[model samples]
Target: METFLGIDYPTLWFLVVGGLFSGYAILDGFDFGAGAWHLFFKKEESRRIALNAVGPVWDGNEVWLVIGGGALFAGFPVMYASMFSAMYIPFILFLLFIILRAVSIEFRSKEEMLWWRKMWDISYSVSSIMLAFLLGVVLGNVLQGIPLGENFEYQGGPLLEFLNPYAIMVGLTTLALFMTHGAIYLLMKTEGRLFAKLTILVKRGIIFFVVIFGITTIYTLIYIPHLSDTFREDPVMFAVPLATFLCIANVPRLAMKHRYKLAFLFSALSMSFMLMLIAIELYPVLLISTIDPQYSITVYNAASSEKSLGIMLNIVAIGAPLVLAYTVFVYSTFKGKVKMDETSY
Candidate 1:
């Protein structure tokens, strides 16, 4: 077992994969959140402003998703194969929505007809909402455990079985969280009446997220006891959740103080913390097998060869910083309120 800073290659790759996805969730999350609020703005000008708020960086943000998916496939091919196969339907739907979203964003303002714009607006919003929800549903199912039979094969009943109550709840919670996150982003990128409207929307979004989050938390505690086991075993692990709560609480507080920049920062932090909690809970095990615990895909069983991981880690060491630098440069270049020029989306 090769080690990197006292952590084995498999565990180190696990952290790498997790970090990539966490970056995806934080970056693309606001895009989905912003798109989800498309139809909420009634006027054409307002809608365009909202659309343009994310227009500059939305595609760049999706780079994280691409990198994250590639990392997963490279780092843990077995777990990737098993999870993708089991959740094939949802992933297909996710792909469909992703295409629809990109199309809507690119083509919505190309035509002068009101009907055409309305059609794309609806497509964009619905696709955005579903995309966010599906991400959560997948996460919930992963947390809940899938039916893996012999040889890490999926033995789940049917496609619709993925839509269990817990998964749906998690999906809705994800949607709410994204909507709130998007609203805060909008606040930073708008002014005057649109800004005032977003302030109200942000408040409502916060309440919506907090309520759904509370219900989801209660349900997880009551129904999925395994998620909390790690915290119970080590009292210090409780600090993560506590910090997550504080970060979440700070979003609204900063928003109320008209400090949307910090609000957005905290929103991104809260998301990072939540994913961290998930990683802590599911360490070692990449995908749990409900059919037989022994068949579960774990870090050790699912990872690629140590040599491959070491080589990739070296590549990532060079590539990741470049990607991060590019991302920072893009955002810094397009910082502040969106101005609708002729080329605007």
Candidate 2:
């Protein structure tokens, strides 16, 4: 067993994969959140402003997803295969919605007809909402455990099984969180009436998210006791959830103070903290097997060869910094309110 800084290679790779997805959730999350609010703005100008808020960086934000997926496939091919096999339909729907969202954003303003723009607007909003929800559903199923049979294969079952109550609750919770995040982002990019409208929306979004999040938390505590085991064992681990709550609470506080930049930052931080909690809860186990404990795909069982992981880690060491630099540069270049020119989306 090779070690990097006293952590095993597989565990190190697990952290790497988690970090990439966390980055994706933080970056692309706002994009999805922004899109989720598309239809809320009635006027054409308002809609366009909202669209342009995320236009400059939405596609770039998706780069994290690509990198995260690739890292998962490379680092833990077995887990990737098993999870994908079990969640094929949901993943396909996710792909479809993601494509539709992209297409809607790109093509909405290309035509002059009102019907044309409306069609895309609906597509964009619905797609964004569905994308966020599906991601949560997948996470929920992963957290609960999948039916992985012998040889790490998915036990055959109806696709509708993925839509269990827990998964749906998680999905809605994810949607609410993203919507709140998006509203805060919109506040940063607009002024006057739009800003005023977004202020109200942000408040509503916060309430929506907090309510759903509270319910989801209660449900998890009541139904899925395993998720809290980590914290139960180590009292210190409670700090993560506490910090997450504080970060979430700070969003509305900063927004009320007209400090949207801080609000957005806190929203992103809250998301990161939430994912960190998930990572802590599920460390080492990539996917739990409902069929049998022994069949579960763990980091150790699912990871690639240590040599391969080592070489890839070296490559990631060089590549990740470059990606991060590029991301920072892009966001910095496009900072502040969106001013639409002829080329705007």
Candidate 3:
């Protein structure tokens, strides 16, 4: 119940950051997921509809990620430094995909050429694939811990350390989640034949996602024993993921009814639950000390000084709503079924 700027700082920070990330995921996850299924459409026209539904909104959605980064740097500088330094290679690749995906989306539409469109489609799919993988890797490294040494520095090591068996497995699971998310998004945002096809794909994806996610959960328990304590301690923590999965599990029924919003909401719930689980596992440790647990960076270790955090609290309160309001305005104005016959692509 600590207060900052005449308001509770910790609560506000968590609420703001959580809301921003959750909002971003709920909105953009589908688009990212939908684009991830780019390879599914052999025909350019069908792909166009899927692309159009997300194109207007995808880049804007990612602004939340940028905002999250800014907040971390400003309010959680130690976590930022440690994470960026340790995960430098993956982060760079992730950015490259983001930039390429954004550029390809715009450039592909300018030309009516089939090859250009196909290239962009591949770029989008490739970028989407990498995006999901990088996300899981980031989460895995954070929760699972990376190589840190004396005084909490990212003691660079062989690339293999980052690509350990568990890390790779987690990457695969994340890719599956994004694929399902993209498929569900397509079902929600588009209509006609494209929507029907997307609906089927998403429905099918649910089963696979469930099995993969289950296996990953078990593996995570065994692979990263340190994380199990958090999950074991709180029975309710498991409910978030279950609730999210239940939404995905029932997406088939919802999709057939053309309940696009609910479908997407469920898809978002699934992803969010998984993310929450990760955060729970990482709880107090913002940056773990690989050399010694004594040198770890918890919220207390990585968070800014009380006074500085107080100042940041005021700044975030002002900035967050403006971003969310604009984002919502853009989406609401753009909402509804996407038609390929229209000026799409």
Candidate 4:
């Protein structure tokens, strides 16, 4: 446990992994949210506008997920192996939809045929929704923990265990949150009739997310006691959830004021704060064992050697800024409302 600054290598890697995944969630989240509204836009032009809104950065956004996965594998090989093996089914479906989503985005405009476009639109929306849901499901499972035996292996009965009520609730909440985020983005990138329509949709999205988020919070407080243990110990940590609440509340207020950019910023902040809460909750532990606490895989026990983490940290230090710069450039290049044309997605 070599220390860097005031933190150890394993803890630093944990933060790295958490930050990468949080980046993925925030960057890709709005695009997935946009795609979730694909089926709602019946007009070809509206759909195209929606697609083009995210066309420039969707693929690049996914790069975070790849980097996050690689970081996880590199930093915590044991947790990666065990968790992936336990949730193989969900991960496979996630991969399948990831491929389907990319194909849908690419192929939807290749043909002018009505049915062909319709097919891809359905594929894209469905895939995006499923991807968000599955991600939340994985997170929920991680929070709730699994039946881990000796060697930190999953000892659950079947894949069905992954879809319990709590996980499903989390999945739905994730979808709602993303949809709300997407709607706000659409609000920013549209005007006139479309903007008016999105305003109403954004209100509904706000309602949906609020109700579901409230339920998820209550459920977590009541049932998932482990997640709140840290907060319970350090009462000051309550500020995180408070900040998350204020951020979520600010989104609607800002949206009402026609401050869509600020709303989107707050939405992104809410997500980051939520993920920060998760990181705080799971600090040392990567995967909790339902069967026995002794069997849990923690950051310390699951991490690679200090030398390996040190090398990768240097690599990430150099590479992450490049990725951030690229992301900023892409968004800046395509900022403001989307205009449809032959080149449109």
Among these predicted structures, which one has the highest lDDT?
Answer: 1
- lDDT tens digits by residue: candidate 1, 1-345: 889889999999999999999998888899899988888899999999999988889999999999999999999999999999999999999999999999999999899999999999999999999999999999999999999999999998876999999999999999999999999999999998999999999999999999999999999999999889999999999999999999999999999999999999999999999999999999989999988889999999999999999999999999999999999999999998888888987
Candidate 1 global TM-score: 0.99
Model 2, span 1-345: residue lDDT tens: 989889999999999999999999888888898888888899998999999889889999999999999999999999999989999999999999999999999999899998999999999999999999999999999999989999999996887899999999999999999999889888888887889898888899899999999999999999999899999999999999999999999988998998999999999999999999999998878899889989999999999999999999999999999999999999889888878798887
Off by over 4 Å in 2: none
lDDT of 1: 0.94
Error of 4 at 338 (Å): 0.6
Q: Write the per-residue lDDT of candidate 4 for residues 1-345, one digit (tens) a residue.
A: 578898999999999999999899998999999999889887888888888888988999999999999999999999999999899999999999999999999999899999999999999999999998999999899999998999888898965889998999999899999999999988888877778888888999899999999999999999999999999999999999899999999999999998999999999999999999998998789899999999999998999999999999999899989989998998889898988877888
TM-score of candidate 2 versus the correct structure, residues matched by position: 0.98
* lDDT per residue (tens digit) for residues 1-345 in model 3: 368566556445655566667766666666667777889887777887878888788878888888887877776787788888888888998889989988878888888887887888899888888887787777667767776776578886886467766677788777787777778667667777777787678766766677777897798778778876875778877776667667667665676677767766776776676666666666667767667787777676677777777788778778878887898799888877785555677
Clashing pairs in 1: none
Best model number under TM-score: 1
> Model 3: runs farther than 4 Å from truth?
1-15, 234-248, 252-258, 341-343
For model 4, the stretches where C-alpha displacement exceeds 4 angstroms are none
